[model samples]
Target: MIYKVIQINFFMKGIDRGLNNSVVVLLIIQI
Candidate 1:
């Protein structure tokens, strides 16, 4: 169970990073 939670957290972090990257790209385009 602990391992599963850790895996989920890692997956979520990756998703967050992807979203942040996309937002940065959009902001750069707008500028």
Candidate 2:
């Protein structure tokens, strides 16, 4: 559950930063 929260936090941050879709996907995949 904590890991899931972390992933969501990162996802939100990536969107807030306007990161590329592929980069966000990669980040999620990496996590």
Candidate 3:
């Protein structure tokens, strides 16, 4: 169970980084 929680947290952080990257790309395109 502890390992599962750690995996989930890692996955979520990966998603957050992806979202942030996409947002930056969009801002660059808009500008």
Candidate 4:
């Protein structure tokens, strides 16, 4: 159970990073 939770946490972090990257890209485009 603990391992599964850790795996999910890492997965979520990756998704968050992707979202942040997209936001950055959008800002660059708007500039």
Badly placed stretches (over 4 Å) of model 4 are 19-31
lDDT of 3 by residue, 1-31 (tens): 8876776676567677776777556544644
Top-TM-score structure, candidate number: 2
| RMSD to true structure for each model, in Å | 10.8, 2.0, 10.8, 10.9
Q: Which candidate, 2 or 3, would have the higher TM-score against the true structure? A: 2
Model 4, 1-31: lDDT tens digits are: 8876776676567677775777556544644
lDDT of 2 by residue, 1-31 (tens): 8988988897998899999988988987877
Tell me the lDDT of model 4 at 30.
43
Q: Residues 3-27, candidate 1, lDDT per residue (tens digit)?
A: 7677667656767777577755654
TM-score result, candidate 2: 0.68
Worst-scoring 10-residue span by lDDT in model 4: 22-31
Which scores better on lDDT, 1 or 2?
Answer: 2
Model 3, C-alpha of 12: deviation from truth (Å): 0.3
